[model samples]
Target: MKVLFCGDIVGRSGRESVTRNIPRLRQELGLDFVVVNGENAAAGFGITAKICAELHGAGVDCITTGNHVWDQRDIIPYIAQDKRLLRPINFPPGTPGWGASQYETARGQKVVVVNVMCRLFMDPLDDPFRTVDAEIAKYTLGRSAHFILIDVHGEATSEKQSMGHHLDGRVSAVLGTHSHIPTADSWVLPGGTAYQTDVGMCGDYDSVIGMKKEGAVLRFIKKVPGDRLAPAEGEGTMCAALVETDDKSGLAKAVRPIRIGGRLPPAG
Candidate 1:
């Protein structure tokens, strides 16, 4: 299975870049499934129903969220109905929306998409490791879940990296998100799970993780909120990780970092 996982979609730039490139990308990469983190999809905040539907129509099979899953109150109703959008699995029970979803590829293959958020420097939620472990167990019965894609959303690379190792062989791919900077450590693990420390942001590369550079700089330098930061209007890149998983064993065969457009250097 050719699965492409894109990192957080920032603001307008991210959405525009995705709308412009994803259709072509799907065709060029021969992607069977596509998952994108929509935590930052709406103006660098949370995602909404409209945006989620738009992205889905644009070829993204599933959308995942992190700590910012509920930033937009309007999503509450939409999330309840949209099975394609997933919140963090670690979120306590009774939380709105699901943490994982199952989709059928064009060829009728069962693909499972799971989203988990790390506790380190994140919300005080349930243990992601335990939650995902249980979730995996539920799906692994008789290999019901053929292809598994895990989106580990967090701030700390160590936390993300640890989750990847924890899920190593059991999953098809474990890609990190939320840092908004693509890591070079895209490789298939010893156990065959594709792993990357971060998949980066699909937005303006000239700014700080897709936010306006001047505002981000001001916040860092002054340590005070003067004005709301907006998405930068610069050349953007669609940062993602491409992974190919075996059909029979459901293990990753190859992994590669993908960067197109923007100021970021090309990924080899």
Candidate 2:
């Protein structure tokens, strides 16, 4: 199975980049499934039902979110109706949307995607390790699931790496998000899971993590609340990770990072 996991989409630039390129990418990469982090898709905040439809229309199979999953008020209700969208698994039990979902490809292959958030330097939610373990215990790779992918959204690289190692061999891939910078650590773990510290944001890199540079820089320099940071309107660069898994064992055979458009050098 071939799967592509795109990083967080920040704003208009990010949305355009993804919606415009996903079709071609699906054809060129021969991707069986595509997952993108849409937490920041709505003006550097949360996503909405309209944007979710846009992504799905562009051929994205599922969408995952991080801490900013609730930034937009309307999404609270809309999320319940969208099975393809997921929030952090560690969120309180009554959270509006699902934390994980199983999807079927065109070939009738089963794929499970889990979305979990880490607590270190992030929101204090349920124990991610325990929650994920309990959630994944229901499915056995190669038996119930053809591929298992987990999106570990967090601010700390150490926490992300820890989760990756902890779930190695049990899952097909453990990819990180939330930090808007791509890391160079795309590699298959010894246990067969593909891991990357961060897949990076699909937004303009010229700004501060996809935000307008002026306001973001001011907040850091002045140490005071000035203005709300807005998304950079520049052209965006879509960043993602590609993993091809074994059909029989459901383990990753090859992993590669993908970067297209904008300032970041192209990869994959």
Candidate 3:
């Protein structure tokens, strides 16, 4: 199965870039499923129901969020009803929505999408390693599910890498998010799980992680909040990773990093 997972959509620029490219990418790449992270989609904060609808209209099959999942107060109601939107699996119990879900492609290929957050440098939530391990055990890859995509959202690279290695050979891909910067290491692990430290943000790259550059610089230099952070309005760069999985073992056969528009050079 061929799947494409895009990083966090920062704001208007990010949303526009994604909606513009996803349809073409779906046709061009012949993708079986598409997963998107919109943790920062709402003005660099949290996602909303409209944003979720837009992403769905743009051909994204599933949406994932990170630490910023609940920033927007309106999403609380929408998340409970929408099965496609997933919060971190490690979230405390009774949290609205689910962590992982199984979906079927138009071609009848079964795919499982799981979102989990790490503990280091972030919220001290449940153990992600243990949580995801138990989730993966529920379904046998290549038998029960044709593909599995895990979004490991976190700040620490070590934490993300640990999760990748921990789930290697058992799932299709274990890609990182929340850092907003894509890493250079994009390769299939020895165990056949495609891994990338971070998938990067789908927003304007000219500023500080999709934020207004001047304001971000001020906060660092002055160490005092003068104004609220705003999303950069410039043209955005769409960043994503494409993985082709083996239909037999449900392991990655090949992987490619996709970067289009804005500052970053176009990559596939």
Candidate 4:
């Protein structure tokens, strides 16, 4: 099973980059399933219904989010009905949308996509390790699913890396997000699971983690709250991971990061 996971979409530049390159990537890369983190798609806040539709139309199979999943008040009811859109599974019970969803490719291959936010330096949530254990127990790769993809959304790299090892042989891939900066450690674990510390943001790298440089610098220098953070308007670089998992054991056969159009150059 070949799958691609895009990092957080920061703003209009990120959306435009996805809109422009996803279709081509889908075909050129021979991707069977595509997952995108849309938490910061709307002005560097939360996602919206319209943005979700655009992403779906752009060949995204499932959209995952982190703490900012509810940034847009309008998404409250919409998330409840959209199975493709997911919030963190660690969210309290009765959360609007699901945290895990199963999707099928045109070839009749089943893929399970799950999102979990870590508790370290992040909003209070259920123990992610246990939460993922329960979710992985429901379906094993190669039997119930051709591929299982987990997006570890959090602030600490230590926590995300821990999740990757915890589900090493049990799932297909454990790709990290939420840091908005691509890391260099893209490799398949000893247990055959694909892992990356972060896939990075699909937005401009010229700014401070996708926000405008001037405003971000001002806030840091003065140690005072300044204008709200805004997404950089320059052309974005799409940072994502393309993984090919084994068909029999559902383990990762090959993994590489795909970065294009902005500051990052061929991080794969």
lDDT of each: 0.88, 0.96, 0.95, 0.93
> Runs in model 4 with CA error above 4 Å?
none
**Candidate achieving higher TM-score, 1 or 3:** 3
Q: For candidate 4, lDDT tens digit of each residue in 1-268? A: 8899999999999999888888999899888999999999999999999999999999999999999998899999999999999999989998888999898999899999999999989998999999989998999689899999999998999999999999998999999999999999999999999999999999999999999999999986897888888999998999999999888888999999998897778654
Screening candidate 1 with a backbone cut-off below 3 angstroms (N, C-alpha, C), the clashing residue pairs are none
Model 1 scores a C-alpha lDDT of: 0.88
Over 4 Å off, model 3 = none
| C-alpha lDDT of candidate 3 relative to the true structure | 0.95
Displacement of the residue 33 alpha carbon in candidate 3, Å: 0.3
Model 4, 198: alpha-carbon shift in Å? Answer: 0.6
Clashes, model 4: 0
* TM-score for predicted model 2 compared with the true structure: 0.99
Better-scoring candidate (TM-score), 2 or 4: 2
Q: Model 3 TM-score? A: 0.99
TM-score of each: 0.97, 0.99, 0.99, 0.98
Model 3, position 139: C-alpha lDDT score: 92
TM-score quality measure for candidate 4: 0.98
Give one digit per residue, the lDDT tens place, for model 1 in 1-268: 8988989999888888787878998898898988999999889989988898899889999999998888899998889888899999888889888999888989888999999998888888899999999888877721687789999999999998898899989999999999998888999999889999999999998898889998889887896767887888787798999998888889988999888888888663
Clashes of each: 0, 0, 0, 0
**Arranged by lDDT, best first:** 2, 3, 4, 1
- The weakest ten consecutive residues by lDDT in model 3 span 219-228
Candidate 3 local lDDT, 1-268, one digit each (tens):
8999999999999999999999999999999999999999999999999999999999999999999999999999999999899999999999999999999999999999999999999999999999999999999999999999999999999999998999999999999999999999999999999999999999999999999999999988997868889999999999999999988899999988999999899999
